[model samples]
Target: MGQGRLPARLGLACCLLLLLLGGSGGLGSRGMPRGPWEEEQGPVAEGGPWGRARYEAVKKHLRAVGALSKQYWQYLACKVWQEGCEEEEEEEEEKESSPSPGLEADLNEQLHGQHLAKEVVVRAVQGFLQSPQPQKALVLSFHGWSGTGKNFVARMLASHLYRHGLKSKCVRVFISLFHFPYHKYVDSYKAQLKKQISETVQLCKQSLFIFDEAEKLHFSLLDAIKPFMGRYDNKGQVDYRRSIFLFLSNLGGNTINEVALDFWRAGRAREEISMEFLEQRLRLELLEPAENSYAHSHLLEENLIDFFVPFLPLEYHHVKLCARDAFLARGLPYTEAALDEVARMMVFVPKEEKLFSAQGCKSVSQRINYFLP
Candidate 1:
């Protein structure tokens, strides 16, 4: 019994020694004991709340360096690319803003027979340019017989004002013969016209609208344009006052010719025939219902138009000028005899008086080749 108790005591002592070694191994796995110098300097704590704190400090340092490097590279790239882009944009704007000398010269050359019309046009354009901000769009109505340079003047205006001239996307031309050929399709034409005007103005405020053969345009269609002709303010939908509207019509041709002829017969200077004198008769003929006139439209009654430019009947000398211009355009030699011969060939109305060219310069281009040698 004494021997068995001795063996049990020895076993107990061995178990206690194994437990002490296991605790020592766990402490060694975490870290070695601090030396004398490390203890004096204060040992860095490990495997406690301080471990997570050290990891976070290293992560924050890396993020700051990375962000600074990224910002520096982005700034360098912007300096290189943005400068070139801005320069190109500025150059393009300058080119678009400057007026073309060639266009102005061409307009002055082509439109020959009407001094009054030219003066009116120049003043109107000057007014448009001088205005700091226009409240209403410039509406010009050209009334004359066919082939009286009405269309020619309109095209000239478009070419001079726009960068791409008549071909510009901002310039839109609608012919009654083409766009609104059928009178029965008035509703469709009205909707299309309104949509086009709205879309065009929305895209560009300086857009131009030309309505050729405006006399034949449906009255309802003219009514649709009333909104665009109104005074525009900052509070309005859009300020389309910078736009131009040109209406070419033959509605008051006879009245305009009669007034011009009277002036000529009275031996008065063409300049003496004031616009006011012509305006009364013209307004009467255009607003009154005649046998075969488009004067029934309320566009006249509402007085929406800004100007009524009357193109006078081209005389014999005027036709001669047109022939000379046509010859010059074709690079042909200039000759007084050639011009005189062409003018003589043209038929004039009133067999006794023979005052004006019946067809004006309408056939000048066609008749020019006959005398060209």
Candidate 2:
């Protein structure tokens, strides 16, 4: 070896021997390497060894990793190691974000009457979600009277689509009067609404936004939503194609009720009141309204709304069914006679046929207080 290199190599070897000798050697009581707990509990040897295990232990204690759920801990581990985390995360998101396969069954069981709503909502949602790359977000405008299952069906959709239902961060419900009461704050509401939509879509790819009393929403607020609902998917921008926006309104209740009454008067089944019969009329009714209304908004003018789902007014039989459900839900025992009493207590319309319930089972549950002893 060269004289200069020989001395440098010898110096490194000597340093290694010195550290081994000065620190822990092969296993003796004092020379043995310390464990995680011992390092924390025992007196500090400032320049001592701190291995991966000790750091991991410190992380566990400091982060309260033990208190986390198994799924969360698995996620944390997967996040750090990145072994199959993408697949697991995607799978979990799909389960949480996608509409429930049981939605049809839920509609059948929970929702009474309104065959049009049941069929349209289920078919439209399923078809929209199945599309690989949808052109625009699924826009469903539900038109009907109060207690006609608009809000109920909205809740059902949210519950089925997300793990946390209406409470999900990915889901938002804006009641026009509650969220934005004053017409004076329209400008501020528009900005806030747009920001909320952008942030929500960024956080969750498949989000659900339900606008209750949608008919009362200011024209500016609806215009604010135009950009998000329009077919505009940039390369690295917020893609709203996978999202769903639902508008619940009682704007066309009269037209829908008239048709239902006409069908009843002609001895036709409510089921036979076809979508063709009501959809055209409902669309016209909503479109031919006053200026600055839902019809005048960009959403309708551009025809961005995919489907106009109409909820038919509930019948006395339907109201009775609702009472039955309420009774069952409350675990209260009731007879068919009791159900009829509750149904009859609700006000019916047309004054002569008294065919449909005016309130449409709106207060059927609270009305149960009548029979309580």
Candidate 3:
């Protein structure tokens, strides 16, 4: 369907170029030929000084126009047809091995209100990739509330590391409530989970396996992945040390919020809330045997999960910033009042004070349609 547009675009470009060259009282067909007066003045010796100068001048203008036409054609072709644009693809392929800088920059620019995530995730992945002989796969457990940018950060990691990002064959995402809801099929779930992981690691030298709503994952199913993340690779087996595993969940979201609230109440800077403060609290919650699946997980027991990255709750200004970004992304004209309106639409928690966004920036993008023209 789009093929027809290419020739049309080139034809339009030609017409525009002709019009540009042929302006008011300007040269037309046969008026100023491509080269010097060929038939009218057969040779340079037959032409006068004025004719010679005109020939040289025309030659100079033609040379300049030729260079410009070549450049314009290249630009037009790349824009309309998207041909010869492999530089971006090549750069993406190159960043596969060294992606910390890009990931860090993306986290800083795109993801807001998560200091620890921006700091730690890039560092951990960079270190793991640089390690010549890693003992096990790099595992990052992302804990936060919905819309706190856990999935966003995961995507940033994937985009920087893989050319196709999450869509890459090497990257796999498993959601809890959707993928494995029935406890009756836990046995089969374990088998399928192992098979998928094995196949992915075997197919790609490096792989990314993401388990969303990880806290709700069946303990048995979670245990099924233990072999792949073992400290030592089994002899003559698919090696997984080069892979990365991400566990995204809301398991410790409340704990993280409580800690943030405590810092606020204490009049301490939010930046002062360190990783140690929340890691211990999150670990305690995960270890409890009564509530969820983290308790019986082998990943925790063996201390195989390398990092427990926390996604802090978002604030009012952070939501505004997110809304501003949304407006820019959607190419909609906005004002401070529009941004305020979008942020006000969100339900905030601690009802009396309305300190934090209850849903973070989850639906902010969809809400922008209300203000669309």
Candidates' C-alpha lDDT: 0.74, 0.84, 0.83
lDDT of 3: 0.83
Q: Considering lDDT, which of the candidate structures 1 and 2 is the better prediction for this target?
A: 2
Candidate 2 Cα misplacement greater than 4 A, ranges: 1-95, 233-236
Off by over 4 Å in 3: 1-100
Residue range 1-373, candidate 2, lDDT tens digits: 4788767755765565444333422444576544334443333335665666667766765454334344444654465445557677567666777667999998999899989999999999999888898998999999999999999999999999999899987998999999999999899999899899888887788999999999889988898888778886586477888889999999999999999888888988889988987999988888886753687687877988899999999988899999999999999999999999999898988899888888898999998888888
**How close is each model in CA RMSD to the real structure?**
23.8, 11.9, 9.4
Ranking by lDDT: 2, 3, 1
Task: Report the Cα lDDT for residue 12, model 3.
Answer: 93
lDDT tens string, model 1, 1-373? 3777656755764564444323321233247532222222223453333355555754664576466555544443344333344444345434543344454456567776676677777778668756888878888999887777898888877777776767876778999889998879989999999889887776665778999988778778888888788677567576789788999988788888888778878998676888878878888777677643246556667777888888888888889889988898888886898899988988886577797788888878888877655
Stretches off by above 4 angstroms in model 1 are: 1-109, 233-236, 291-294, 371-373
Best by lDDT: 2
Worst 10 residues of 2 by lDDT: 19-28
* TM-score to true structure, per model: 0.71, 0.76, 0.74
lDDT of candidate 2 vs native? 0.84
Candidate with the larger TM-score of 1 and 3: 3
Clashing pairs in 3: none
